[model samples]
Target: MRISRLAPEVATSRLIARTSGLLTVMGGLGAIALVLGSAGAMHPGAAALGPVTAGVGLVVMRWGHRIPLSGYRFLMAAGVVDIGVFAYASPTVGAAVAMLSLSAFAAMGSFLFFALPCALGYLAELLVMGAVVVVARGDVDAGVAGVLAVLVVGCAGAMAVVAHRAATAHEDALTGLVNRRGFDEALEAAVRATARTGEPLSAALFDLDHFKAVNDSRGHAAGDEMLRAVAATWTPLLPGTAVLARHGGDEFALLLPGSDGGSALACAEALRAALPHIGTSVGVAELAPGDSPADLMRRADAALYRVKSRGRGRSELDAGGQSPMARDLAAALAAGTSGGLSVHLQPVVTPADGEIVGVEALVRWTHPELGAVPPADFVPVAEREGLIGALGAFVWLAACRDARTLSEATGRSLFLTVNVSGLELDDPGFPDRVLATLAGSGWPAERTVVEVTESLVEAESTRSVHALHVLREHGLRVAIDDFGTGYSALSRLDTLPTDFLKLDNSFVSAITTSTRRARLLRSVMALADALDLILIAEGVETPEQARALASLGCPLAQGYLYGRPRPVAELVASLTAADVVDPPAVALASG
Candidate 1:
């Protein structure tokens, strides 16, 4: 609560209060020892003080949290009085030298709890008090002074080593800013602290816009220098309440307690102006009501992505509530994954035998007031409102968990396909998150497939492509969804990592009547064969379309003809033991 630059290192008030309690008890015990050794030279009042001090210590220890600022000043003041009493009353140089041990505890307490300056001042007070006592003894105990000096200097040195290790462990060596671990701790603390005070807490993420280019062109050393320079330039300009950390390579995180979104943006602009050389993309978001630290960071990070997508070298604040519906939907997802939001399952079938091979997980939200909100309406709201990542994560977790149940409930093994947004795909961590969901839900990675829109794959953002590759590398399959709808060069198919291609519904809807469309479907089947990719025909609504797909030797397809999207429970319940569903769509698929 000191609001110093080393606020992170400050000892909590409870810790200081408890330390004070312990020291007071020790001081009382020492008084008892002096009385016992003095052979009736000490007064009875001094004897009575021992029990009183010990009792007070117990109270202080028990009620430490109630003390102001957790008792930093209280402990410091107590240490001063304690040393003064010991120094003023020491009868001999030997006694004075022995009293320096008490100084060591106080020194360690001060140095460990307070910042460098305050810790050093406390250490100096102890030494000066001990020196005065040593001189007042009227006997040259140069040895005692030497011992006192060692005790003080040694405590300070030990503290220095400890402080260095603590800083290095949490500090980024390159930029001398807080590391990810430190930032996480501070952010969590700020969230709790702001919640208690009802003060605003804003979080922001910063990334060097062209950092990769700088690293590639100028070498890593220059990149390191640039990062260091940026840190150095901005470090002093930041307020004590603000914490700046290196979130990861070329990225930074900042926490500003007591600042709202607007104030955070102003501070961000100042930081942007400070960075003379390279441009940055920054996202800022304030702590919304009922927000956890993770939620705040996601909103900020999402805004950062939005900035990069629009055009970099700018800052964007997740100005919460892009619309009333968006706000309500975001809250619904946060309230509980199962409360109003759920993942529905639509079968992806094998056309030749009309057997269900897998299911595509579709996210559906049934609002409490609005009934079933269409994905078409809500998904855009999620993207625009920076809730897509949260929405995507929820779907992945819920779908994977449900997919396991789908397999268990039906006595069938099925692969799970979950669609991803372009914004989600663009994130480098998206694949790892998906892998986490599978692992956490006890689902096999080999049986999982990630569906990305064909339009997204066609654009070919390097980050998005890399994310898909990462997924495939971990035994997860990638599918180019709604194929033939997006403008992708056929040549790209050779290099793009893919395992399945679902024909766009438009292509399937017309394939029954249009010879040209049927011929194109045949060509697509051949292309799938050449690429070793499976083809799933989408929107097989009629028996004629199903037979046409089977005639063309298309391996798999999914649509209302197979089954409409349903809850995993209902979908599994409607299926027979052989994985055949009792539906007209299933009959239609059987040819």
Candidate 2:
């Protein structure tokens, strides 16, 4: 197998071992040459010691992949043995210099193993180097030898620090698992291996169910402990060939080589069973012909979405076939008409006064036989089956009609935010279609916000940009939804035709639990302020989170704390009631 196919840690160990082995062999050959050239003065025992140690070191290096961590320790011990042989057989300045250089190299290699061992190894090397300098004073100037020894040890220490930093950059600070960058590299390697060998390659994406509840209820510290526990429990259970990485907050991805869907599913199930208390949902997809890394991950994510929708604490495998449920969803989308789809509104309120400032339009689906199908399950199907345009039209018309009614009932202006898919944006007639919808409902274009996700905005397509500018020119507002969750280039905010930035729920969830996250939220708020964009924080589930957002100078927030998504009539009733009460008391009454 290629060294790149090995696990990162094992690969690193193998590289260090091979390098040290080669150096040992070179030192041995040099020692033998010295003995032959010096004739009567140099001892033959020292010459034999080099070649013998070199052979053993090479053998250890050959097996380095199997004994990853231990191989480095053996090499370090071997270096010490080589130094002892040199000091005893050839007690001269040249031998002293050779042993000291070998000791420095060994010290540098120790860092590839671990931190504590590296520190101890460096100290031991320093002591040995000092003794060599003192013992060889008769052959060389003591002052000069001491100064060279200091320089060599210092250079070795610098090399160790550099190596440690490089390794740490690829490691997750939270769980000590491979981070996203490392995961991408490992995934690319797996893809290459599969292409070469025709071996089955599978990937699984897992999300911890209700992990936010743990962070919100117990504390962030407890949540961190839970994540650590998960990593520790699952790492040993995985096959050595499998690569596990922390994809991000509350999510993990696994790369399994030489495994088909069945094996991957079994592994995911075993992981779920092992962590029953911390419920997890997993999605597995085996590599298809001519698939890239992104294609594999997307399919796995779609499968994960299936598990999350059906229920958490389960594993589902994608075998490149349509499931019966997906077929039903596709059928339902095809039959979607006015009655088949409905709009639900969740209020976004001012944190200080708790007055409803806006409402986010969420689409829900219910079928005769399928019961209440969640939007997560069917939205992708709709998008994939070319029904999103029809679905989007329905949502926009319904939301505008309801928003006009709500505003009339409450006797106040209320802006309505509706989600627009990337597919709709790419449509040449999207802007004209939106205007027609608003005109049909007699809702002012100025009061409607078309929310697009960060990913779409990052696409920066000419068509999308032109469509957005057209919508803006018509007095409609554009929002970058789920900000900070994707490839968010904050600098682009200045150039993109956007009016609002909705900070994603992931950051909001951790705001109260992590000081660093809290600071980050403040920084994001500051950026929005500089861009002159209205900021709305999503997923504000607690009064504490609301207060935190307010303290950070965020004016608007939305989540279950204000109200869960409900029918338009219920939202109108709540809005009417809030209008009658003192605005400051509205929050308490709603709670």
Q: Which pairs clash in the backbone of model 1? A: 13-70
The candidate that wins on lDDT is: 1
lDDT of 2 by residue, 512-546 (tens): 99999999988888887777788889999999998
Instruction: Summarize candidate 1's per-residue lDDT along 1-591 as a digit string, tens digits.
Output: 432234345455566567667877786676556645654343455355556666777787788657674355566656556665654565544454555566777777666666778778877787787777667765736876787789777986797668656646788888888899989988988888887899989989998886766876899999999999889888898998899999888888999999999999999989998986689889999999888897888788778877776667899999774588987887898787656998999988888767776888999999889999999999978986778988999999989988899888866667888999888987778888888888899998888888887666554555777888888888888888888875653657887778888788999899888999999889988888877788788888999999998898887888898899999878877884455543222221111
Task: State which candidate has the highest TM-score.
Answer: 1
Candidate 2 whole-model C-alpha lDDT, 0 to 1:
0.75
Q: Superposing all C-alpha atoms, what RMSD in Å does each candidate have to the true structure?
A: 6.2, 16.8
What TM-score would candidate 1 get against the native?
A: 0.74
